[model samples]
Target: MTDYRAAVQDMNFLLHDVFQVSQDWATMPELAEMMDADTARAILDEAAKLTETLIAPNARQADEQGISFKDGEVTTPDGYKEQFAQLAQGGWVGVTANPEFGGMGLPKTLSAQYEEMMCAADISFSLYSGLTAGAIMTLDLHASQELKETYLPRMAAGEWTGTMCLTEPHCGTDLGILRTKAEPQADGSFALTGTKIFITGGEHDLVDNIVHLVLAKLPDAPAGTKGISLFLVPKFLVNEDGSLGERNPVVAGSVEHKMGIHASATCVLNFDGAKGWLVGEPNRGLAAMFTMMNYERLGVGIQGLGAAARSYGTALEYALDRRQGRGAKATQEPQAEADPLIVHGDIRRMLLTMKAFVEGGRAFSTYVGQQLDRAKYAATEQDRADAEALVQLLTPVAKAFMTDTGLEATIAGQQILGGHGYVREWGQEQWVRDCRIAQIYEGTNGIQALDLLGRKVAGSRGELLKPLLREMTEFLQADAGQWSAEYQQLADAVKSLTEVTEAVLAQVPSDENIINSVAVEYLNLVGYVVYGYLWLRIARVAEAQDALGEFASSKVKTAKFYFAKLLPRIHSLRPSIEAGSKELFSHELNEF
Candidate 1:
């Protein structure tokens, strides 16, 4: 198996130094009394140990063994159940859930790093807790008090895992065409009958029961998305006293044999008159599901970050150890036949690119984590509103850019490893396969681009952009002399982004396809600028703590490299976004 280690040093640097999450925790009553820097770091330390030791060992083995379906039951690979039990017992599953419900209730920023580490260690296993926690978020936010009382504690304890079922064979992003039906019975429950595909953790032997958050339409409800309703359908019926009664009518039709995450049971779930309870209200499932989706979208971004971080770690280790190339300068080991791969300029370029994306992605992900925590835990309504708006504006960027960079970073790592990266034993190719899904799932990157440029930016007519814009200005203005030129680049990038945003918004009324034609570029522009600002933040901190020596120096150099190489790519996107949809629309289906 490929070696794996959590980036605990950098994670703490981000939490305590860059973000200074201690200040936020001290101010928010939701976590002020219970969480501190010391506690959060301790949690990270323990999580690192578990991830590196227990969880990671199962990754390659699971891929080799793969998941199997017999009758209606799906079995996880060996060691998964025991490791999952350990994960539940370790309290990692509920790292950020409410303490009243057995969670640590720490801020999302700390939990976000833990998620990243889990993905680095092993993403397939991590999906169990990731999806469950997202389900817990939906319940905490929109479920009735009774439902919360009945389910939150057990789910938080990981006694029951959870799954979100949304996509049907006929519908994935377009939920309006969904054919799942939920017929209300006299006992205040509903009978759901439908076939939902691409349901992750839909069935597994790791937990006693799987709680499914199903989106189905109710009879007599209005047509389209407005008619959908959210239901909590358990794999096994939970009695009034919270113990398992009988098996619900939900079954795993079959588990997908996919490109990656072989241990994670992504199943085609068939609900035939399954007994389920209403979650939010009738005809409001779409909105309720978004609560879970917005949370999971960030999780997916972290998955991308995790993939990048792990791939970089592997590539860096291999480059330092693998000896095949001669040095451009004086070789450190003059007596040796050849220098390490690190001597090659092209190899360094690949490594530096991975480092830039991984570190920048880390900072960017943490920034969004802070926004999400504030959106949920800020003491005042205005603060919450501002943070919520920032979250809304950045979610699509977080989802799309991180995954896109993650795929790129993994491929770069594979390139660094030569042929070894492509083989199963090296595990770099697995990184590519696993990271590929993040871009496609949770609304494909195409859908995310449209959501960002159309719904979040153009839909609000620049109203939603102000919160992010104001913060970008504040971050740029707060910088020291460490990265003055990069600061200007960031400022200019955001300025151009603003101009293009306004231009696109103005023409949106006349050209409905304008956002579609340019949104991918627009979102990429936003992401590159965000990452540029993040790199500046890291470098500024590194400059202030120059006593740290090479660690600090490396960061400064990488920041410079990012500006020289990556950030300039935004200039290319501007022309593309400015080209408008006319040329794109001019082509017919058979034009090629």
Candidate 2:
């Protein structure tokens, strides 16, 4: 297996050339003061060093050793403790946390690059800090001043860790039906009692305490999702002086044995009358949790991107080094018995397919990060609102579509290795397994599709999508020059997306089940269109570079590959989306 290398060069290209985030930051005073262009580049360089030297070398060993759960305590792999401590000491746990609360307070655009590097190095290692970051964001936004002061600093400083406990054994997507109970106390706290399955970082020994942001029901609260409220339950209680107190009843019943990411602990937590505090207002818990969930959804998308990026690097190395068959035209190495895998047409296809998806997804993820920065720090309310709308419209696609293609890219990478990929020694199989879970967790790809088509699009009466459509249309209306053909193809794709959306929304009135039936296809269509738009932007930026170096030239080539080959996937998805629910409803469940 090839050592994991951070795509620092590509990341710099996106930050400086493609997005020009420094310019965007200058418009927002808060962001402008945060850091300059040199500082951002320097930070990325440092992160690249840390991930490559420290985190990545432990990934294979961690996977082979897994986690050791004994009695009630869970222990990670051999070097995890020391590595995590180093990560925390470097203040990486709060790379994007509030500086006022011991966090670095960096913008998402910059931190996002750091995130991708971490995930590529070791996704299992990244989760402990990633969940902590998410929990810190939620507390910063919604927690009371006292709670924020108590928890955020500790979490940000890496003295403690956090987890989101939303899924029960019986409920995953349907949060309204969860049976967790939160009883109010005279001391103004709540007593949480329930079981939350599939909680990441629930019982890890990397931190002193685990802060769980739980979803439960209050006694007088209304029924369904409206009644849900968010709570903060800790594994070990904290005293008034910020010292560790008695242990709370929140315990991990067992850690799940999973197919991949063996280094990360997936626990089934039991809250047996655990002491807790309210996060947001009563009956508004879902809203508060969403602050974390949205951040995580985007983070999960990056997880897929990270896996794909790593897999691509490994595959590319193998393709260049592993000699297979002769080239179609002639043997490049006349003295050699055979040629490298890169000389074969099918192998080149697989490598380019992986490259196209990985690079395009990276660009898309960074763009989403820019929108997030705008949503937070933009000068005007209208700009912030516009950024927020785009975030809403694209969050589902970022999570679902990225993971779908991420899995595809990983598999293609694995296939490039043939028999070697199936065995553990090559490490390609592990990536394939790990990438698969990204599509299933956070929310299944199917559920993400439903959210994109049903809630964000049809539920909003297409208001949320209009902002993105307009943005893409405006880009197409701009000057293209030599890239006119690619721009036109993207324009056609955008048109197809708009038409398909309108057609689906039109059918929703008469065919109530249409959204559920055609949602996955519609989401893919939207994904391909959005990707096509991003590819155009990438190609344009690469072409406009003063010195079209290897990196810039490759970007242009990859963008061309995406348009010529992958972007047309929208065509097949469009017909499936337009077909409505009739064929789906025609079959009975037991027919098979």
Candidate 3:
């Protein structure tokens, strides 16, 4: 794990040379001063140092010791507190938060790398800040000015942490059946009473004050999701002059004993006549919470990517160090006793598979992060709208595809280590366990797939996908002559995916279950096509750096491997998607 690097070089390559985000940022009034390549690289380098040296070392301690829950209080492992304070003092907690509220005010394009590095260093410790960042962003967008003035400064500064309370004991994805009740007081605040479960960072010793963004229903509210409302419920009530008052009626009912991420507290929070304030208009709580959930979705996707990246580093190390097998075509050896595991073809295959997906995902996530930045800071209305559309279209893909592939990469890494990976000390199993939750929480991969197919694609009738599809087409049309063959292969896949998308759309309205039936396959097809385009981009850049010799050559080789081996999975997925839901529902519930 110590050998693991955060892929800062590739992140910089994507942001500065490939995407030219500096140019985009320079044009925007808000980001001009801090948008240069040097600043971005410097920030990434600093983040790498912080995570690698300070934060990463604490990960094993946190996982092994786990957090303690006694009397509604959760205490992190020994080193967790000091490292967390360092993280907050560095202002990394609010790297992309609002400038007016003491945040760093950086672009998501840059901060996304920070989030990735932090997660790679220590995900358990990182969640506390990650959820806080998401909450601050939501408050900035939807909270009233008074609320923002009071809450944003402390939260953005990391003095007060935040959590999102959306799940209930019975209601998970189906928020329409939630039973949380909110009664309005004469002071214009609401008295919220509900028990929210699976709330991450719900109660902790890291901060004295914890702010919860809870979703509850008003008395006269409408039925279903529309009736739900977002509220800002603090652990301790804030005084008029912005001081901490008496403790509110919010407490952690219990902490969940989980298979992984033991250092992070997952609590069942009980709100007993708790004081809270409305975030947005009534009956639109779902929409307001999306402002936070959408941010967390990408953040969660990066967590998966980080897990894969770290696992790949650890597995590669094991393969290089462990001596057993000989090369397939070895005629001679310096030491005739044995050779390293890397000599075997099968091991090389596993390593390459991990390499291809992790690198491809790096490109994809950064591309999505750039879109997030443009959506927020691009100069024109249409530019902003286009970026926003692409953001909506790809958010679910980033969340689902990355986590799905990430889980695969981790398991492959575990297999690479054989018996040692199964043991606790080797830490490969921990990577697998920690990463498993990302796919399940923050919306399951299945749910994300449905969102991609239903809401983002078919619901918009492919209109939402046009901006991204057009970007791929225009890039192929561009003068990327040196990598013509690979680019052309990606071009063909893009065209095929476009046709499949149209076919899926046509079948969705006619068959009610079409989107649910083909959602996972459709998302995978889109992911492969997306990764193909990104691989070509990476290859073109690698080719320009032939002077660097092996490093650049490896990049080109990985691109070829990805296109040749991994991209074809999309072809198999297409037939299943087109085959529709008839076979899926063919068997009755009693038949099983």
Predicted structure with the largest lDDT when compared to the true one:
2
Per-residue accuracy of model 1 over 12-89 as CA lDDT, tens digit each: 988888999889888898788888989988988998989999988778898788788899898899999899888888
How should the candidates be ordered by lDDT, best one leading?
A: 2, 1, 3
Off by over 4 Å in 2: none
**lDDT per model, in order?**
0.89, 0.91, 0.89
**Model 3 weakest lDDT span, ten residues long:** 325-334
RMSD of 1: 1.4
User: Candidate 3's residue-wise lDDT over 1-592, tens digit each?
Assistant: 4455778877887887677889988988999986688988899999999998898877887899998999999998998878878888999888878989999998888888888888777789889999999999999999999999999999988899999999999999999999999999999999999899999999989888999999999999999998999999999999999999999999999999998899999999999999999998898989999988877999999988898889899999999888885676653266567788888888888999999988888888889988988898889999999889989989999999998999899999999999988987778898899999999998899999999989888888888888788988998987867667777788888888888888877776679988898899989998989998888888888788767588779888999899888998887998998899999888787853
Write down the worst ten-residue block by lDDT for model 1.
325-334
TM-score of each: 0.98, 0.99, 0.98
lDDT of 2 by residue, 509-535 (tens): 899899999999988888888888888
Cα deviation in Å at residue 26, candidate 2? Answer: 1.1
Scored by lDDT, model 3 comes in at 0.89
lDDT of 3 at 267: 98
